[model samples]
Target: MPTDIAFLAIAEAQQLYHWLPAALELARRPDVRVSILSPSDQILALVESYDPTGSLRRVRLRRPPSRPDSLFRQPSRLATLLLNYPTIARFPTLVTTEISSAWLRRVPGFRSRLILIKHGAGDREGGYKKRHRDFDLTLVAGEKDRRRMIDRGLCTAETVAVGGYPKFDLKADRQRFFPDDKPVLLYNPHFDPALSSWINHGPAMLAALESLTDWNVIIAPHTKLAIKAPPIVSSAPHIRVDMGSRHSIDMSYTMSADVYLGDVSSQVYEFLIQPRPCIFLNLDHRDASGDAFAHWKLGQVIERADALPQALARANDLQPGFVAAQEAAMQQSIDLSPVPASQRQADLILNFAKKGV
Candidate 1:
């Protein structure tokens, strides 16, 4: 028998946690048969770790036997796209966390309805791609994205659902990186060259943290940065540096940190879940008036590493002035309720599947 709905888990592991909860929720209902499809053994293994009871059935897609790389293009992803066309054709409705999967809509005989559940709730312009319109339905973390989708004509009110962050539904072990209870600062930076503070201000940022005797620091950059860059190391007893590890992607650092410090990574929103002190870096000196950096208003915004001492001194005290705004922004950025986000997403997916579009 054909699967009623299949989740295409073809992206990086960081993105996997975002959509897995909804798939597991769908599997609980007897009327719906849900399966997870992927070409990556690593992704499949991670999926199994979450669905240990074998609730989310797995199907492995094919990969090219061998392919040469050139300066402009790597064929691995494109090859996977071509090789998996037949498998993608079998499902009635397909749900994925990746926007690139929309490329499959161009296939000659493809008939499955495409549904997208965005992985991140960041405010970067990259999140609003033209390709998003290709999907039949979209699920976003908050009303912030839903409004942008409608404003950009990427999706309509009916086609998009305000699904809260499904990744929040996932629970990971909390870890303590520091021996003492000094305030912990999580310094996470984005990988984007145009926006990242690490490219130009990283070493200086680390130096600023080392100068602080009153704080414990976790210098965890975005997971994508560790992909091509060398591992960042810190020898300071109070400072811990993680380039990319399971702890980085699993919310270990975000949950453990007391003060949030970063440039423009979306992880700031994740850190804001508890409404703690947040400090944003504007090292590149970009214009701050844009909506892309709206979260910056929730806390102090500094332009250089030299300002760290003064900013850290005031971050917590300033929270009362910003807490109300932070809470308001959280409501704008995520939809929360008595019903779990996973179930809400599953309800939408199942209803879409029932339509036989």
Candidate 2:
């Protein structure tokens, strides 16, 4: 029997990258029926961008009904889910990147199997929430997360599979953002209020990056922060500040950039894909020995924004020193497979649904 599967792109557009590839991979199969659901046209359009070959069909889910500005600032995601509950309840298996979907279980007579795909491979404590156990099946991008989950008693080795990063399945279009061919530095920060380098250092960091006359800088933070981020005007022509454009989420900056500058964002893993120069900001002077700060070992760590220039100056020279470690980390974290990650992940999901084990 063909398993009815739906991939939820109902979250932020940035998260859609994590699950859509696997959904597209499953679309090519005759035994698995796949549907892509989203409330944002931006998300739907992004889905089509990835499927230029026209392999998957999309359903534009309706957002909550309009209300006055005084009543509703923006529609809640949960409202969208509740409004579409009747339609969402029809699928036997639902694959999503957000854990907030656990709300589906509280609905009366809802029996759909829920699967969580890791969106960002980060070490923040928020990554291992207790609600994670609510899912019937969980798919992770790497062994690093699997080990963390098990160590936290969230799952056993048998409960999770070492599925590779699905975002890697995205083909890069490589948009050239700058006119001169100077090396590009992508300064991506996480949105987590507690761990984000942006909440405290964002404005000043912008000032620091704006002053860089030698290197081209791309200020692309996490999509969640983009929701209410203040407008930033850059004086330098080479300093391109992208709060959250489609290019920010579509691997454009990751592929185009030559160096990575960040604090605690998992996009660093994506940046490390090419093993270029990397510099991490520890401006607040956090303990380096802590598990949350473990990934800082991948590159040079600076204590202040003014140090950014010096760090970038020596990034390439110090890059070769860290390349071997970066390669080893990526090897242990992401499962590099002969078969594409999306195919492996989709096969695991469909097989899990079919066996009902």
Candidate 3:
């Protein structure tokens, strides 16, 4: 019998780009039936757009009950997702990540082959470490990244390196950069306090950018950046703030930008893939410890908000060595060989299902 597979993502609809590449590839398999389990209407729409003929099945999760204290919201939502797994488990194979997958595996009926795909582009410290024994297979982005996962004992050496970021495969359009005449600056802040700019001196950083009227600023903050109302932000005319959008994962914004700025978000790795100048907010003020991709060098690590002007100057300066180093690290972080990454990932999932290995 042909293998049936399911793709699951708990991320919001606008944030679905991170998983699209893997989902798209799995959808193309002639021997594998693909279904996407996501809650966001936007993600459902995106899945349909990519598979107009209904090649991929989609299951939209019901919204979890809300509580008075927002912190309790996580456990509630997680419980809600866990309840949906038995229904999802009817498929013979499951490809998922984050807490949803972790919980789904606990269901006794979900004995089918499970492939856990890591989401971040580079190895970063302080992410959830799942025992490889729980997953039938692990999917990583590149060899170095795969090694990073192995070194942490997070997964067995069986993890395969699949060279694509599913979200990056979205069609790119230059029109998103308009008014296209000005140089675009992408401000992407990291989420964690241990390695992010917003946790320490976000206001000062925002103030620095407020003065820059001549440049075009596009703020693509990490999805978790603003948890509360008003989003703990100060706005300025020059900056176009994206809280989150239906078109979030397109990545054309990163490619269209002249310079990328932020702390330790994976957007840096994604932006560097294009060889653009970057300004790293050295807010962590220490070396990366746990994440394997720490060896990657960032261009112009600025230690303070006062250094914004200088960082911008350095980005505009276009240092050859800096650009080259970043490019090399990007290549090492994600394989950009001749093979189309999406197809490679699709093949891995399909083969795993066939062999049941």
Candidate 4:
């Protein structure tokens, strides 16, 4: 018998690099039935970008016809919990990411056989899993994350390392998007306050990078960072801002950049897989106390925006040590073996679903 499995996301985060590829790989299977939930048109647009035919059945939260700006007022939003409560309550197995963990805990009699996929680079600041070890399996990118999850007690010692983001499955090839004439700089800022752009002067940090010459810059900040205001793309002819839309699963820009600049965003780890130079901006100059990705020891930290020009110069002058360190960390956090990562993760999800049947 085929088990009825539903994959839920709080919003359309599946379009970006971390979650979407895994979801896409899983959705390709005939046995697995996947669904998504999005309360807004923006999210719906992202969903359509993936499954445009409306072939992918998505669950809509029951809500009053009035479009409530607040999630609390949306009847459709309310319907999600009311609807999922029963499905989750009776389903033999449930898999979700941390974004929906709080809701899952509230579901009546529905907290067994759960899987929590570690989404970001773990850290004490990102509220690294202090509670709710109810998950039977925790999908981690690599050993470093596994150690932090275990050390922080985010999950039990039984958690398994499934390798890095299924998105990296595309990195095995060497297709160039642009002519290899100029070096490309990918600015991947983190969304967390303690680990990223929210606390530091975000707009200023970006403006400073605008002055650089010769290199092409791609401003690919964290997805959540755009909720406040869409990122404004500005720069000399060499720069391009990816702020027009959020890329929840697309990371080809990050993979192709020659250098990376940002705080604790996990894309740094992903960019590091190619072993390019990465620079950390200590925008506020505050110590990133207990940030797990910061501890990865891959790049340099610039304390002042004025130092950026020199930092870029140094970044270009030096051999790619940061890239090599990122590769090492990638192996430790995800499997560096020759096998395809997306297929590996898809197989694991399918096998888990099969057992429930």
Q: Point to the candidate with the largest lDDT.
A: 1
lDDT of 2 at 34: 82
lDDT of 4 by residue, 78-120 (tens): 4555555654455455555654444566566664466666665
Clashing pairs in 3: 21-166
For all candidates in order, the CA lDDT equals 0.84, 0.81, 0.66, 0.61
| lDDT against true structure, model 1 | 0.84
Off by over 4 Å in 3: 67-77, 131-133, 176-180, 228-235, 287-296
Q: Decide which is better by lDDT, 1 or 3.
A: 1
Clashes of 3: 1
Q: What RMSD does model 3 have?
A: 3.4
Q: Write down the TM-score for model 2.
A: 0.93
For residue 180, model 2's alpha carbon misses the true position, in angstroms, by: 1.0
Misplaced by over 4 Å in model 1 are 1-3, 65-75
Model 4 TM-score (2 dp): 0.79
Please provide, for model 3 over 325-346, each residue's C-alpha lDDT reduced to its tens digit, 9 standing for 90 to 100.
8777767667776766677777
Clashes in model 2: which pairs?
none
Q: Where is model 2 more than 4 Å wrong at Cα?
A: 52-54, 66-74
Q: Which lDDT tens digits does candidate 1 get at residues 128-233?
A: 8899999999999999999999999999989998888888888465577988889899999888878888877778987898998799999899877765456777
Question: Model 2: which ten-residue window has the lowest total lDDT?
Answer: 66-75
- List, in order, the clash count of every candidate structure: 0, 0, 1, 18
**Better model by TM-score, 1 or 3?**
1
Instruction: Give TM-scores for every candidate, taking all chains together and pairing residue i with residue i.
Output: 0.94, 0.93, 0.88, 0.79
